[model samples]
Target chain A: MTKITFKDAAGAARTVEAQDGSTVMETAIRNAVPGIEAECGGACACATCHVYVDDAWTEIVGKPSQMEEDMLDFAFEVRPSSRLSCQIKVAPNLDGLVVTTPAKQG
Target chain B: MTESIETDVAIIGAGPAGLFAVFELGLLDIKCHLIDILGKPGGQCSELYPEKPIYDIPGFPEVSAQGLVENLIKQIQPFNPVFHMGEMVERVESLGDAEHPKFRVTTDAGTEVTARCVLIAAGGGSFMPKKPPIPGIDAYEGRSVFYAVRKVEQFRGRRVTIVGGGDSALDWVLNLHPVAERITLIHRRDAFRAAPHSVNAMRELVAAGAMDFILGQVSGLKGEGGQLSALTLRKESGESVDIACDDMLPFFGLTMKLGPIADWGLNLHENLIPADTEKFETSTPGIFAIGDIITYPGKLKLILSGFHEGALAAQKIHRYVYPDKRLVFQYTTSSTSLQKKLGVG
Candidate 1:
């Protein structure tokens, strides 16, 4: 199992153990983490699961795909670090991934 | 006033479950009129991700969302179900009593449908435009700010600012350019998700200095009493710029909301209608619900589960539509009457 941490806008962090092949959004939803709506259920269709990867973990998590970037246009307050958590896969390499959920998702 | 449509069953929503319900009700010789807020059929399947593939649909190993919707529409074509598209249901009045229940469903577009029974197959409710998180933006809504361009005359001789990089933004920018005194297109990044042709047209206009293209996000709105004066935009460099405009249109796509359905007086559990597993009927007699908008003991939000619920609900609805006629369970493969209804006999 890979360990991942999710932090809310207020800096409250919750770390959970995510199984390999699952996504960060799935882990967040499995753990009942607040602020991650995942309205499209990880199809990367809706941008409600928008998250800001920590600056240190940006290189490790990698950039979003072209399709995800198109969908990100629907999100609010997007930044260089903004990525839809549904597109980020959970792996042993990303065991210590840290991401912050935005205050409001469009 | 136009004449109201009379049918045996009035099914709300044109999604997968609702479309399948028409087939189920049609097999029982029940005519139906489908009402949906979207202009076309396939609610979320067509609206959200039409090109995306779905795996869980029965029989089909894998099918695109639009592909499944097309098959469902074709499967129910023999029923000749009438469609009232692009209208939101405003009110549902129970006209008849418990023994012989009837409902008069009204839409915002002034369309009325009276039926022996009403079925709610609305998956996750209606889709509405997603609003940005700008503080105090609600005050300017329907006044200085608009989600949809109802009238092109409203932007005449006005300074308009269109936000977002999608088709809605670019299309409106090019459309309203002739009427508006000035058009400003604002987006967070340089890349656009709109059609390449529209993007090129916008860039050509920008090159000609006909309009302004700014790279930023709307951070705040400056206005008073539902009138917009200017909007504050934050750039990627952490710089803020205030652009003076009388009207602002932000196209951030759509989100599902349980709109108007909550006020219908049905017993709701966490915004979902509570229905029985057997008939899938709501607390209000003759009014049934299925699909994601309903909750039962083992309710799964899958399309197959909705198909099952709809099939069972049709059994009960058949009794209400033809109270004098006796119902005989028959399979389409073995029953000539069922095959005749399918137009395959």
Candidate 2:
């Protein structure tokens, strides 16, 4: 199990233990973490699961793929660290991965 | 005013479930008219991911989303189902009492369908444009900000700013270039998600200095009383630039909403209609719900499950459309009448 923390826009953080194969978006949804609405159910078709990776974890989390970058065009208030949380897979290497959900998702 | 259509059944969506329901209802000699908000037949299949592969469909190892929709369309072709595309069902009025249940369905495009039974196969409600999260942006909607371009004349002599990197943004940038005094295309990154040809054309315009292509996102909107004046663009380097514009068009894609379905007076279980397992009928008699928009014990939101629910719903619908006739369940494999209805006898 990998520990993942999801921070809301208001700075409230909720950490949950996620399965190795599951995604960060799935973990946030399973825990009912506020501000993360995965409307497309992890298909990466919609950009409703936009999140900002914590600066310290950027290198470990890596950048989004080309397809995910294309879908990010639909998200609001995108930044350099923006990622569609569904595309980020959880693993042992990402034991302490932290991401912040956007104020509003497209 | 156009005359209202009279049919034995009115299917509310053109997705896989509603299309299959046409075939099932057709086997029982019921004519149907399908109403969909999208201009095309396939709902999310065509809209969201048409090229994506679906593996769970029986008899086929793998089929594309659009391919499944095409096959379903072909399967129901013999029924000659009339389609009212690019229209949303605005109201569903129950015309008859409990004994003889009937409904008069109306759409936003002024199309009316009066049928003996109404089938709600609307998977995930209706697809609506996703609004940008810019604060106070709603105040400028329909006045100085627009999601769709119904009229090209509206942008004439105006400074227009088109945001997004998708087809809608690039297409409109090219289309409105001639009409608008100046066109500014804004995107977060330099890379575009639109067709290569459209991207090249936009780049050519930028090279010629005919239009402005900025690499940034719209952070705020400056407007008053539904009139947009300028938009604040924030660059990746934390630089904010205010571009003066009279109109702004953001081409963010679509999202699903449970619009108008909540107003139909049906019992909703967390935005989904609660239906019985046997007939797939809703709390209201003669009104059936199926597909992802329905909720029941052990209900799965799979395409195959929807097909099964539609088949059972047709059996119950036969009773409503043909009240005096006895329904005899038959299979197309051996029943000559069923084969004849399929046009394969």
Candidate 3:
């Protein structure tokens, strides 16, 4: 099990187990953490799973596709560091990954 | 004189369409920016469940909902796109014309972002589960009643009664049959609202004495010490009955709210933006809509359909951004170009 920390909209830190091959978004929703609503069901058709991926993981994280980028246009507070956590699966190297939820629950 | 970062395209909502956009646009070498309100991408699938198995999405055989997001995000990682989170788009600004409209994205926090293009992948809206308006309903959330269940393991050996009649309700009944000690399916009316096949299967199971069913309306709930105890029901004959159970599951329908975007007033009908179904463009120029949020000219709200619409919109955006690319390249890679540039090599 991989250890993943979720910083909810309230800045609450939640440590959860993310088994290998699981996305960070799954960890958050499974734990019932607030502010991480994946409204599109992982199809990347919705921007509800928006999160600020710690820039330090950029190498392990890589980048979003044109489709994901286009979907971000409809989100609330998109930033240079914003990433769809569902797009990123947890790897052994990402043991201590940190992700923050947007304050809004759209 | 300025080395400031400039964004070419900005996509909203990091669901399938958004993730695939990165794949499509990255092929064309068009850098873009991405944004979404949830802390993770994949919209409803990831937001709701990562462990829950899904059978509908194409190209997969019983894939976990979370599994799809991981693959999609990986597929689009080749293209580096910008990301924003915890932000709601307040408004979109224009640069006076469609050719060079400076897209100003304002957030609820008053932060502003500028991009050339914006894609609305916000999905079907924020879904709030609709429950039976029984007496003291809110008192049972997380105790006797639940808006959703992410873990089926929690209900092991527990007697669970599920309300409502839909795909989720029937599906949950089927999933929980082996896990729970006893399963009871409830609905408001005698006719089920779930898919015909699902309903048929459920009927078969109940008739064979595998599950229990009550054709009535929920009237009240009785619980103890933060744990669900029993359910009060009004039978179809107008008589009231009480059933003792360990848990109550209300598989009622979900209510989707478009959120603040609904206020934009894109000439909507029945909570959807009406547009040319093929174009996916909203009534207003420089502003488009897709996914379940759009309706017009015989349209069905489905995730795969949104993918097609989003691709079409991106191609249209590409054409709009490079209206003369065809004309410019008419003499570059075409037979005419070979004749003019290389003299028929």
Q: Per-candidate TM vs. native?
A: 0.98, 0.95, 0.45
- Residue-level lDDT of model 2, residues A1-106, one tens digit each, is 7999999999999889999989999988999998888887788899988999999999989999999999999999888899999999999999999899999988
Top candidate on DockQ is: 1
Ten consecutive residues with minimal summed lDDT in candidate 2 chain A?
Answer: A35-44
Alpha carbon deviation, residue B252, candidate 1 (Å): 0.3
What are the per-residue Cα lDDT tens digits for candidate 3 across B238-265?
7889988888877644435677667654
- In terms of TM-score, the best-performing candidate is 1
lDDT string for model 2 (B1-345, tens) is: 555899999899999999999999999999999999998998888888788898999998999999999999999998999999988899999999777999999998889899999999999999887889888999999999998898999899999999989999999999999999999999989999999999999999999999999999898999789999899989888899999999999899889899999999999989999999999999889999999999998989999999999999999999999999999989889999988888899
lDDT of 1: 0.94
lDDT of 3 at A26: 84
lDDT by residue (tens digit), candidate 1, B51-73: 98999998999999999999999
Q: Give the per-residue lDDT digits (tens) of candidate 3, residues A1-106.
A: 6888878767789888887887878888888867788865566655678888777876677787765665554354456677787788888988988888887533
Name the 10 consecutive residues with the lowest summed lDDT in model 2 chain B. Answer: B1-10
Q: Candidate 1 residues A36-71, lDDT tens each? A: 999988888899999999999999899899999999
Docking class of 3: incorrect
Could you give me the TM-score of model 3 versus the true structure?
0.45
Which whole-number lDDT from 0 to 100 does residue B316 have in model 2?
92
Model 2 misses residue A32 by how many Å?
2.6
Residue-level error in angstroms, candidate 2, position B97: 2.6
True contacts kept of each: 0.83, 0.83, 0.00
* Chain A: TM-score in each model: 0.98, 0.97, 0.90
